[model samples]
Structures are given as C-alpha cells and as structure tokens.
Target: MLKSSLNKGLIEAGCDEAGRGCLAGSVYAAAVILPEDYRNDDLNDSKQLTPHRRYELRKIIERDAVAWAVGVVTHEEIDKINILNASILAMHRALDGLKVRPEAIIVDGNRFKPYNFIPYTTVVKGDGKFMSIAAASILAKTYRDDYMDRLAEEYPQYDWISNKGYPTKKHRQAIAEHGITPYHRKTFRLL
Candidate 1:
C-alpha cells in the first residue's frame, strides 16, 4: 500500500514526469495533492498499471485530489533545455496551477530544480511508495500517451500510437525509413 503522505502535517504535493526517456514528443509532468484519507487498492506505480487502469485512476485522482495539474515541455524545448531541465520545468509548471499550494513537494526522482522558495524532497521510485506520487505518475503518463496517440493520426509513419515516442525497435525502424519528423527530438539518438 502506498503511503498517503511523506509528512503528516505538511500540505505535500507529489510530483512525477513521463516521456523523459522517449525519443520523440514532449515530456509531461504532474503534481498531485491528494487528500490525506484517499485510498484505492489499485493505486500503485503508473508503470505497473495497464492503460485502462491508469485512465480509471487518472479520473479518480482528478476528481478526488485536493489539487492537481499536468504540464508539458515541448520537443523543441526539451532539445534546447535538455531532458532533465525540461522535466523539472514541466513539474514546476504543474505546481504553478495548483489551487492549494503545497507546503512541501515530494518529487519522484533523485533530482529536481526547486520551485520558487518551496522546499522539496526527491525520492527515487517514489511513485511506488507514495499515493500522491503514484497518482501524479498516472496523470503524466496517460496524458502524454493520449497526446502521442493523437499525433499518430497525423503522422502514421512514426507509429506513435504503438510506441508512444519511445525508441522501440519499430520506432527506430520508422526513423530510418521515413526520417525524423518536426516533433522528433533531433538531439536524441535512437539506438
């Protein structure tokens, strides 16, 4: 079971990003501040859940959370700022939309550029350990996946609906066959 919060007293927001490792598309991030009493048996790391389950949980989290927001850093921005900075920037943007400001932020990775004067704690694999983080992960992944799926309609060559911009075998083959699209990150080498 994922813990509800890291610190009981602080109004904490859990932060996570998706598509950071993808070869194309933007990196998406979400900051979720769930109620302390929130609980769901299916709640876990977004990666562990199926697409259907993630979507179900995403709706629940959006409806039940105290505050939540998703943000994206475009492929062009990711190329210019680098994935790490772009990911953190996306997280900052998500936090910016929160109706309830967090007292402290708990990010799901080992590195984060601080948001404003608010202090933050970075925990590796935090999504599996904290409910709010897990919720954030689901929101980020589903939203980004949905975006890629829509893009797939416009650029069927990339097959983003299947690979979701990841450097999968078919995606790399598509890159070799058709060349990169404007959405593809030119700096990223697809191996």
Candidate 2:
C-alpha cells in the first residue's frame, strides 16, 4: 500500500514529470498537495495503471486534493537546457501554479533542485510508494498524453497517438522517412 505522505502534519506536495524520455513534444510535470488524511487503495504509479484508470483517477485527484497543478516545458526548451533541467524546471513551474503553497515536497525521482526553500525528499520510486506522487504522476501522464493526442492529428505519420512520442521503432522509422517536426527534441537521438 502506498503511504499518504512522508511527513505527517506538514502540507506536502508530491512532484513528478512525464515525457522526459520522449523524442518529441513537451515534458509535463504535476504538483499535488493532497490532504494529510487522504487515502486511496487504487492509487499507484501512473505507469502501473491503464490509461483509462489514470484518467478516472485524475478526476478523483483533482476533485479531492487540497490543490493540484501541472507544468510543461517545451521540446525547444528541452533541447536548450537538457531533459534533466527541463524536468526540474517543469516541477518548479508546477509548484508555481499551486494555489496552496507546500511546506514540503517529495519527488518521485532521485534528482530535484530546491524549490522555495521548502524541505524536500527525493525518493527513487516515490510514485509507487506515496499517494501524492502517484497522483502527480497520473496528472502529468494524462495531461501529456492529451497534448500528444492533439499533436498526432497534426503529424499522423509519426503515430504519436500510439507511441506518444517515445522512441518506438515506428516513431524512429517515421523520423527517418519524414524528418523531424517542430515538436521533436533535436538534441535527442531521433534515429
């Protein structure tokens, strides 16, 4: 079972990002500040849940959480600053959007820059272990998925609807055949 949070009484926000590995499109991150007493057995890593379940849980998380916000860093920015920095910046941006500031932050991965001088902990696989991080994962994944779905309409040849801009065999083939889109991260290995 995922724990509600790392800190018991403090207002904690969980941070997570999606699309850091994608070859195209923007990276998205979410900051979720759930109530300290919240609990949901179904919540887990966004990756562990199906797309349908993630979307469903998104509604619940948004409705029940004390506050939640999403942030994005575009492919162009990713190319300029690199994925790691962009991912961290996206998390900071998410925190910027939160209506309720957090007293602490728990991040899903092991790397994060300090945000607003709040105390923080970086868990290697926090999404699978903490409810707020899992919720943030769901929001980030679903939001980025929706953005990619729209991009798929613009560049159907890349099959982003299927691969979501990951470096899938088909996606790489599309890059070989048609070249990169504005959404492609030029710094990434496209082929």
Candidate 3:
C-alpha cells in the first residue's frame, strides 16, 4: 500500500525522471500532483511494473491526478548540460507544464534543485513509497518508452524498440558495429 500524501495539508507534486542511464535518446521526466485523498494499491515504482501494467497505470494517473505533465531533454541537451543537470531541468520543465501549482514537491531521488520557491523533499525511493511519485515515474517511463519506440523506427539498428535505449550489451554492440545515430548520447560511453 502507498501513502496518499507526504504532508496532508500542502498541495504536493511528485517528480521523477527516466533514461538517465541510457546510451541513446532523450531523458524524460514527469511531475504528478494527485488528489489529496487518492489511493491506489497497485501504484508502485515504475521499474517494478511490467510494460502492460505501467501503461495501464499511466492512463489512471493521467485521469485522476490534479495535474500531470511530462518533460523531455533531448540527447543533445543531455550532452550539453550533463545528465544530472538535464534530469533535474527536465523535472523543472514538467513542473512548468502543470496547470495546478504545487505548494511543495517530493522527488523520487536524492538530487534536485529548488523549483521556484516551492519547497521539496528528496526521498531515496519515493516512487515506491508515494503515490504521486509512483505516478510520475509511470508517466516518465512510459512516455520515454514511447519516444524510444518511435526513434527505433528511425534507427532500427540500435534495437531501441527492445532495449529502450539502455546500454545493454546488444545496444553497445550495435553502436560499435553500426556507428552512432543522432540520438546517441555522445557524452555517454557508448562502448
């Protein structure tokens, strides 16, 4: 079971990112502000769920949340700003897309910069513990997966459709054999 709120009083949004460790494609993040009284036991860390379940939850999160938005930083931007900063910036951009302003934020990881004047808490595995964070994780992951699938069509040799741009042995092998695509993160060690 996941808790509904970090602080019962404040309007809170949970933030998370995906594809930070990928060798190719963009980094994506999501900010999700669920209803204060929301409850859904199936909601957990996105990484814990299968693709079918994640997509199912994505629809639920989108439908039930007070506000939810995804942000993406392209591979080029990741190379320019570095993955850490790009991940945080992607979260900020997601927050920017939210129609309902959050009074506070709870991030899924230990790294974050201040978002405007909104106070934030950094949980080591917030996605597994908090509903909003779990929702954010689902959105970020599924959206990024969708994007990777599209990119896979453009660069089928990278096998992104299967690996979703993660640095699997086959993905690295493809990079070594076929050379780099525009979506490859040059800053990352592809080999």
Q: What's the CA RMSD for each of the models?
A: 0.8, 0.5, 0.6
- Model 1 clash pairs are none
RMSD of 2: 0.5
- Order of models, best lDDT first: 2, 3, 1
Clashes of each: 0, 0, 0
lDDT of 2 by residue, 103-134 (tens): 99999999999898999999999999999999
TM-score of each: 0.98, 0.99, 0.99
Candidate 3 ranges beyond 4 A from true positions: none
The C-alpha stretches of model 2 lying farther than 4 A from their native spots are none
Q: Please, what is the whole-model Cα lDDT of each candidate in the order they appear?
A: 0.93, 0.97, 0.95
Number of the candidate with higher lDDT, 1 or 2: 2
**Residue-level error in angstroms, candidate 2, position 168:** 0.3
Q: What TM-score quantifies how close candidate 1 is to the native fold? A: 0.98
Provide the lowest-lDDT 10-residue window in model 3: 181-190
**Model 2 clash pairs?**
none
